[model samples]
Target chain A: MDAALTLLSFGPDGWGDDIATGVLVTVGLALATLPFGLVLGFFVALMKQSEEPSMRLAGNIYTTIFRGLPELLTLFLIFYGAQLGLQQITALFGEETTIEINAFAAGMVALGIMFSSYASEVFLAAFRVIPRGQYEGAYAVGLSHTRTMRLVILPQLIRVALPGLGNLWLILLKDTALVSVIGLSDILRQTGVAARVTKEPFLFFGLACLLYLVLAVLSSFVFSAIERWAAKSGGTR
Target chain B: MNAVAADLVERPPTPSRRWTGTRIAGTILVALWALAIAGLALYLVQSWNPELFDRYAGRYWSGLIVTLQLVFLSIILGAVLSIPIAWGRMTKRRIPSALAYAYVYFFRGTPLIAQTFLIYYGLGSFRPQLEAVGLWSFFRDAWNCALFAFTLNTAAYQAEILRGALESVGRGQWEGAASLGLSRLHTLRLIIVPQALIVALRPYGNEIILMIKGSAIVAIITVYDLMGETRRAYSRSFDFQTYLYAALIYLAIVETLRNVIEWIERRLTRHLKR
Candidate 1:
């Protein structure tokens, strides 16, 4: 027990600091991904709803391709395939610089793109639920198209999108563990290293499980609170 | 009134003929874009190494078979195990419900990869104890560990889904059964379960799809499933095409399953559509 405690301590002999850093990296990846995902998702949703058939088709294909592929396969394709594609493009431009994508950036882009595919569906559903009268009402008030969206549609969209987005967030949080396969020093990867170095897989992996559970539980509470707040605010509006 | 009447008179009688130049252009552009995509796909297929396929075809086939096996066995076993857990959650007893909740919470909260590692490597530390109990052989193999983890994880999800579906069966159904002098078990077996299963079908399909995606993680633990074989081929060739091929195969499987599930859903709910 003492040995185990010492190994988990923050001293030079222990990997406590490493594990802490891993947790931070995982959280940072998720935070960075959230906005990218939401913005792209909103854009895709708009494209799907566009007046132009081509735009709708494009959006449909994008969502179908991304959503159909496994998240891990998407990561690998982006991480390795992106480099090759970039190198080819640079060669065409007569440049010699080799572009490298760090695991974090690759993870962010892959996860963000995948998240957007799912989120677009959620946003599209939310958009569909808005009464047609609301748009007509906005027009009757002499609001511009953009102004109508901002004043009349966006708030309600967010309220309806919140729960689905929250569920996606939980999924995204768990998916960050997959980044470890690409050598990101996230919680799972760090635990893997500690386990290998200390030759105590049970101790380290079990601890990693506990850490993940703590994050999951805490995030669930946070989401529930935000949902309640969204409901209340939406009611007032 | 004159301007409104003029506008109405000028409009085309047929909607199809009302397609302006811009609309025609949009249609043309969409067609051109689709052609470009088709051409790109054709180029990739032509460029693919046929010799490589011939050499690794057997390996890929076996990998695909293993992946299907893992997904099928785990989903079936997990679904079976979920019934008791779902029952525990639904019961009035506090302790059982809490225990079931804890099981679901822990499994759902963590990543499957973490759970896989904990079972595969973590249990290696307990080989001596397992051997003492004559279970070391079961824990020693990576395949068994992967199967075990997948089963446990899916059971938690399936349990929650089943519980929700069962509860969604209206209380009136239970009351009607009781008033008819049917016992609780008989009611559940004869009527409630069938209805609950129909309600649960879609979610069950979703869970299976998720497990199919998640079974990829078992590759990390040295199970030479589809993803594992893909990785192996990639390492051998150092070509990204291997990954694309694997992705294409996965996409086919997912698309097929999606269609199958939709068909089943339609068949099950055919009565409601009327």
Candidate 2:
């Protein structure tokens, strides 16, 4: 027990600092991706709802592909292909500048795209959960489409979408570990380094699992609270 | 709207989307999609390499087999293991229930990759003891570790599904079975399980697909699954399309499985269809 404590201790001789930094990185990565994913998901959900069949088809194709592919595959695609894509675009301008996508950015983009695909489904369902009356009621009052959505629909939509998006956030929190594979200094990576150096693989990896579980359990609590808060106002009223 | 939702008074009115139909939104979406689609086509044309495709075809096939094998074996084994766990979860007994809950919570709470690494690397620390117990060889292989982790992970999920499905069967079924003088076990096996299984079918399909997508993590540990093969090909050839091919293959499998599951659902629930 003492040895374990010393190994996980807070000072220079211990890896506590490194692991703490990793936890920060992991949490930051997830937080940064949240808005990107939410916005992209909202956009795609709108795309699926568009008047044009092509727009709808594009939405369907995007969701199907991103949601179906493994997050790691998407990460690899973004990591390797994004650079080439930038180079290609630059070539068109005859400048040929190369843009390298770091693992953190790649993970962020891949997970954001994947999260959006799933989120769009939740948002779509949330929209559907709002009764036709809400739209009719808003229009009956001569509200513009944008106003109807903003003032009347979105508040309720967020309520319906909250639970689903909350679930996605927990998943995103966990999936952040995947970026460690591409060389990001996330929780798993830090623990992994300590595990190798200390030759105490079980202890370090178990710690990694514990940290993730703690995050998930905490998020579950936070989400339920938010759900309760959101539901304080009546959906029907 | 589905007739059932419409007919079912307690269910909410079929939810309707509040869409952004402003012409500006539509124009922006069109422009963005067009650029995306056009760029994809250009990239495909510019980077098509026939020779690399021919060279890596065999590797991808073999890797796919490994992936399929890993997912199927673990899923089957996990299904078998989940029976008792599910039963424990449903039982009135305290110790068994707590243990089962803990098992599910831990497995479900953590990431698959972390779980995978723990099994793969963590077990090696017990090499001496495992060798003494004559289990070193089994724990040593990356493939076995992946399989073990996947099985443990999927079993918890399957247990939840089983418990939920079994509970979804109405209280009347139990009363009907009891009045018929059937034993509890007999009633569950003969009547309740069948109905519950039909309810469980869709979740089972979803679990299998998740397992397929997740099995890619094993490649990180050098198990040479489909994703593993892609990484190897990428290292050797440095072709971005290798990852694209794997992505498409994965997509094809998921799409195919989804349709198959839907078809099976239709067939199995044919009697209930209106």
Candidate 3:
């Protein structure tokens, strides 16, 4: 009991810093992925919404392929496959390439790409909810497609997509732990290391779990705020 | 939520019929663009080594089997456990409901990898305490530990699915059964569970697919599931393309399961068909 307590203590001997740093890395990588995913998702959504047949097909294939692949496989592909592809590129350029893609970059690329696929679906469905009349009204006023999209469609799209996006963010936050497999010093990896060094798996892991719970609770409040904002904005519009 | 969904569903169809020759050409153009990406990927793999298939063929098959087994066992156990958990959550008493809610929150809040490690390594650390209770034998094995965590995690989600389905069952049905002098248990067993099963079936199928993908985490805990096998195979041969091939196998399983889920959903909702 004393040992378990000591392991969880906030002192230098404790695993607090290590585990906390892991949580930081996990959150950082997840946040980095968010914007990239949203952009990719926007394109996919636009492709999905396109009147052009070929654009829809391209979008469909993109979503289908990524959505169908397991998250782990996607991670491995981006991590190792990207590494190998880069090496070959450098070789062709006659440059000695030793610039390794670390676990963080790989995690971002993989999760960002995967998250975008799900986001596209959310955005697509959200767009579908807007009545055609709204789009027609924008067009009737001689609004250019780009201007109409900028002013009318994007705001409504964000409102409709906010709930689903909230869910996706929660999912991405939790899934950051998977990057630990590729050796990102994330919370799970840090906990594992601490567990191994201290030989007290329960104490460190239990702490890690608590930290994750706290993270979840904190973000849930953030999501609720976003939800309220979206709801209010939705009403005013 | 249901009201919004109902309104959306009741919305009349758009009178846009832009499907034309130009649209067909556009579709082909987009398809070709995607094919170009796929083609590039294929070219890279093929150029890297044409014999990559033969190099890791055997290992990929075995990995595929392990992934299927992992998915099947966890989901089956999860489905079985969901009933009691959902029942506990739905009960009138505060304790059971709170306990059920806590279970859901804890499992849902953490990552699957965290839960997997917590069970595999964390429980193993308690070998002595576990042995005192004669559960050490089970805890010693990675497979058992992985299954325990997966099942518990999935059960939490499944319980929520079941709870929603049960709540959505109309009060009219239960009252109607009561009018026939049926006991509560009888009414629930005959009417409630069957209806809930229909509503829960599709979500359950989605959970099963999620479980299939989730089982890959066990590879980190020293379970030789698909990912584990692929790592081993690649480490031995240094053939990276083989890993790509392994990914395709996972993709195949996902596609097949998706079709299976769709078919099951269609079958279950047959009554609503026009």
What's the candidate order when arranged by decreasing TM-score?
Answer: 1, 2, 3
lDDT of 1 by residue, B151-207 (tens): 999999999999999999999999999999999999999989989989999999888
Worst 10 residues of 3 chain B by lDDT: B44-53
Colliding pairs, model 3? A53-B27, A54-B26, A54-B27, A54-B30
lDDT of 1 at B163: 95
Which candidate's DockQ is highest? 1
Cα deviation of A105, candidate 3, in Å: 1.5
Query: What lDDT would each prediction earn against the true structure?
Result: 0.90, 0.91, 0.85
Q: What is the lDDT of residue A3 in candidate 2?
A: 91
State the DockQ of every prediction: 0.59, 0.54, 0.57
Question: Rank by DockQ, descending?
Answer: 1, 3, 2
Candidate 2 docking band: medium
lDDT, residue B188, model 1: 93
Off by over 4 Å in 1: A94-98, B1-12, B16-36
Taking chain A of candidate 1, what TM-score results?
0.95
